[model samples]
Target chain A: MMSNTRTAIGVGAVALACILGSAQLVAAPKYEVVELAESGTIVGIVSFDGAAPAPQKITIPAGEDVCHSDPIVKEDVVVSADGKLRWAVVSLKKPAKGKAFPADDPEKPIVLDQVGCRFVPHVAVVPVGRTLRVLNSDGIQHNVHGKAKKNKPVNKSMPKQMKTLDLTFKRAERIPFVCDVHDWMKSWVIVSKHPYYAISAADGSFKLDQVPVGTHTVQLWHEKYGTLTQEVTVAAGKEARITFVVKPTEAAK
Target chain B: MTIQKHRIQLMAAIPAALLTITVLAVTVAAPGCATSTDSEPVADLSRAEALFVENCASCHGVSGDGRGPMASLLQVRPRNFSDEEFRYVSAPGGPPTQDDLVQTIRGGRTMGQMPAFPYLDHTDARLLADYVRKLRETGVAKMLVVEFADDDEIEPDEIAEIAEERVAPGDPVAIVGPSAEFRIDTERGRALYADNCSSCHGASGRGDGLDLPKDELGNPIEVRDITSGRFNGGAAPMEMFKRIRCGIPGTPMPEASALSNDEVWQLVHYVDLLAGN
Candidate 1:
């Protein structure tokens, strides 16, 4: 029992150390499949604490008619009429050894379609080892560029009507993707190591079900507001509720 | 004869089916090969935004509009980050990635108004990358793709005219003249440069950096001879500051992302001295 505790401490320390450093990637321990008698659910609401910043208007200054048809209103900070935030990502920073990503093949590809000079579904969740299928639905040219530190970066030109390009991330990462041709066409693909992640709905509510009962670090990430982290404990067969007050960091518009 | 015709038609469909299969195979295999770095740290946007104002605002403008106080007197126009399109990016023949921006920052454009910031730590460079992406996300800045009909087709005269008007198409910004108002401390500039730069750029600034690359036959490939000071980027003090901070891309010079902006300016002055300005 003492040896097992020490081994867990060793793994936890390594994971925490990787999380704290910027862009440092540590080898991850593979998730193991296990039978569990009791599991708890985590539910959360992520709300913006301040006034929503105005939508930025995207205009093509140089390649005018050849690019976008009209000025695109960026959905950076979309708040519902009822004050629910949309597209904010919530997930476990690092899960302890337990349920193996729920799905047998976490490697399934998540489709990201480019339509009307914009990315369909601005924020998408993809399990690590899963593929991100990027399809261009427009007739014009679009270049898919990825800005990531831990994963190999992607900058490929997608000729209109070409078959979809599959992007794979080896580690759990939140990658910001952009179309250089449109410039204003931007989105995110959050590649996770486990299934305990969800994007806040149009109503700003999110839940992570069947999480193994234990304490875990929860992280909330937003493109405009930045990130916030919290520690929550899970009881057997119980639900833990959380509310994240997201404030814009200096990166906020 | 009719039976032979029917069989011929059926055999002709095989290539079409095979073509579809080939496309499908290529399509299925492409995503498995897409480049996605998973080990990178999360972006720290706050830090990036702060640095952009302090280091990049003079040329890139506070709003990242590329209309800083010193707009003119430059041979190559400064990059307008707010524009969705960027000329220099990471992957071959596409828009710049975050790493491309980082590298662009590290290696100042060889023939543009941008400069190197080799002293910067990777963290700060990455933060700056995140900040730029924010501008893209918020739609404050947009870039236009400049699709040439064909590079070989454009005549030299047409190219020269556009080249002469390098800053012609950008959004209107106040054309404040050269504002490279750093107190030219040539003495300090010379000292700092002698220690760090002399080894690569050489004592006389002739670029006799001992290790010049040679062809298979052992002849030296061209290196920058700073005495002429004809950088692909401009020679403005601010431009020099950019080069110092970012370093010339595709060159031995590196970005000093860690260096203070003020220090970069001093090096710019020192480089001017080397150029006999």
Candidate 2:
């Protein structure tokens, strides 16, 4: 009788919570692993349509011998002479069912290293549940402060003697990291929920393979240009080609 | 029928009397560590919210955003509970433990701006700490929604889940003492300070070495003046040890991870001497 009374009292609050939860609160289907007979591919060129901005050099704090070895520059906008953009993240948006994330190998974990006071590979993608092994190769004092919203943020101290630290992200999001001592040091680790994600190369080309045959929304995101999406249909055993031409002015919008 | 009714009433009254005695007994026994279980969550937050508004909202703001009317008047600003990380956390990169929050509320910081509220009992302090924790969790959730507006959609449930996960405190950093054979050496500590900390903290330990450095929130922060003898973190030996070991979160202060235990002790001694302890 007491339990019944409690349930009756909670019903209204439960209803109100559900109402305020989301507009369309339908649960997304979980991804499944299956033997693939046929799969589709997505290939794209995330090119810059306008003249790429000149790379700006960041002034380093004086007195660090290792950091002073090389000049650090702003890596937000990396464009080749022919206007090919670099470091743009591209992914398929919310595929109901597709491929499973890659199996984790503890021996060969994904490494994010601090070399010469800069994060190598300004942008990296790690599958959820996989570990990111952070190394301080500079052998100097540094901290890896991950600014994560979905995952727990980590601000581990990497003193000169400490060589390696490992981190894992449970949720999918773009987490930026920085060093408190070195304010200019920054990097991004995109924890991917699915396998259909790729970072554009120096030639501005990216490819997502093993996608199920369907019309899927493709999202291209850059640190500066923001995000732009395009829809394309994928055919089984065949590749779908698309191009995302980003303009400098689109960042203003 | 009258006899049966009396028996039922007597049975109920016996239990009621026993419950009253138990409540009184517990209340009388409650003191420092007895009533303080920092890990336990409060069942109801209504009273806690009311308490926060009455005592803390003047400086911390009703929303805990650190923009209270008195915030601008204070030389050292009250911490924005929602937006900023707690400076005195023992868990590196994790949320503050309930004890950390409760102690800060009860004792306040050593700095003059945040005064101690000794009048509030331990239970009240715990309630306010729980409320402040909620504010931080809610704030992180809101921040996520805005940050990922362009990227992926985070549902309400996911937001709650993420916020809870992000704010969950981890194990406290281990505190160790100098080795048995180690001896205090202020001269070595002074040399270490010159090599490691002097660049930002100044040669004289006066916090005059560099221009105002930006914190994790990108806000310009004043470096702690060690010579002034007042530490935002407490001046106890262990407090100074933890501060150096973990470093202050969200600040430019780096942990003395490179230094050995002996070296840290030496530095601590040197700092104490500089502060005229």
Candidate 3:
């Protein structure tokens, strides 16, 4: 009888082990493997059509007690009426569908510092739920404020001390941030829900990576110029190029 | 009887162990699994106030009354927080629009005491601007009525023309701010500056580029010694941008009509870095 009891106990242990192993196997997540369909390159030049306009002369009205400096002219950086392109923001609007890229680690967050009264990057692309560390490296005091339609706006003073303002944007928005003390400071933070976005260079060039094989929409935005959208069909492992021309406003002509 | 008592104790301990395991699991998993309160969307006043005191109070006064210690020394008294009379407006007379405030903050009011706070990220500027409006409404409680003389009427187009005349002929490009390194190609920018600007601004951005003939007014116009860090105008990056974009009126400098804003901002960054170095 004692021998029989030992054999039964051994059998029960083996059955429990098999059940647990099966459970684990069944619970494992399944993901589809996607490959690039075709290899194509997308290349386009961004050009502005009109002649560069002359700078604008601005003077402090006689009564204003502001900077007593001489008359100042405004810079004309916006695209002219003749469709010139400079500093146009180009990015993929519709992301290719496939296995999502590994999410960013929250612990090792991206940083956008405000040292010496300026945003580190005029434009930044950050994933959702990622924390942005705004550091103050100036001896003088500065306020770091961000305005976003969907995300909560952050307005805080960055004293001479190196303080980090940790923030996260939950949605995608081309948010503009500035300091009240120093009026001219400005930067754009493009908080995206997905990771596929790029800012056009001063020469107006952009590239998007790891796009799954499919048709997607791309968007181009400029602070001064309006927004432009285009639909592109990207093959697997292939790059499809598209060009966008932004016309200057009538006054610029 | 002793065996029976021991068995009962063992059974009781099993239930207690299970309960302890459940509690431990809940404690460990709940914090990570629970939804965050940030999703609820609460206005964070403490954070906003902290930001205000750090950045705005220096010029706008600690109490949002436009009476900061710097206000007394500044030529254009920081906008009187209590007064709502704003001179810059896009619409004929709409309570200072958000865009107006933003544009003023971003581009900066030219030739005024207000310097561009480009260091403040765009979002930060918007938040602070909104908070300024809030403070104006709550702290000051009334917009200061600004009455303009009939002669003050200047058309936007006319203003644009005056702005154009401000550009200097051989002026260096405008740089955006201290942190504009990422936005600019410094190598290309340095070469451009050397080619177009080095003659007057000097190889090192010092004012001693080259002594040119006297202007029609007979003033010995020296290239702005940018590296010396002595700015007749404000030292803000935007201030430099404005100076580059629009030549300093009455100065020998001419506006840089060729460079784009991005290029100008890069130049501004280079100048700031060179001055600091």
The number of the candidate with the highest DockQ is 2
What digit string (tens of lDDT, one per residue) describes model 1 on residues B38-105?
A: 22222653455557767876787554556766756566556655333343332222234566668778
Runs of candidate 3 with Cα error greater than 4 angstroms are A1-44, A53-86, A96-109, A250-253, B1-277
Q: By DockQ thresholds, what CAPRI class is model 1?
A: incorrect
lDDT of each: 0.56, 0.71, 0.49
> What's the CA error at residue B35 for candidate 1, in Å?
27
lDDT of 2 by residue, A1-253 (tens): 3333223323422322232243225445555567667789999888898987888898886767999888888888899788889999889877777887777778888889999999988998898888899998998767788877677666666766678888888888788888766778899998877788898998999999998888998888787777778998999999999998888775732
User: Candidate 2, clashing residue pairs?
Assistant: none
lDDT of 1 by residue, A141-239 (tens): 565666543344455545444557777876555677776435567899887766778999988999988888889877777777665678889999899
Worst 10 residues of 1 chain B by lDDT: B141-150
TM-score for each predicted model, relative to the true structure: 0.44, 0.83, 0.37
DockQ of the two-chain complex in candidate 1: 0.01
Off by over 4 Å in 2: A1-20, A23-27, B1-46, B153-155, B187-199, B202-204, B208-212, B254-267, B274-276
Worst 10 residues of 3 chain B by lDDT: B142-151
Could you tell me how far off, in angstroms, the CA of residue B166 lies in candidate 3 after the best superposition?
A: 44
The most accurate candidate by TM-score is 2
Q: Write the per-residue lDDT of candidate 2 for residues B51-131, one digit (tens) a residue.
A: 876898789876677877799999988888666877887665546778778878998898858888889998999888877
Q: Interface RMSD for candidate number 3?
A: 31.4
Q: B1-277, model 3: which lDDT tens digit per residue?
A: 0001101222232222221111011111122222111111114444545566677677876445677768888876576543333334322212344555666676665545777777877666666665565543321111100110011111111221221121101222324444544466788678656644554566788766444523213444455677777665456776667655554322334344445577667777777777774
Runs in model 1 with CA error above 4 Å?
A1-33, A60-71, A102-108, A249-253, B1-277
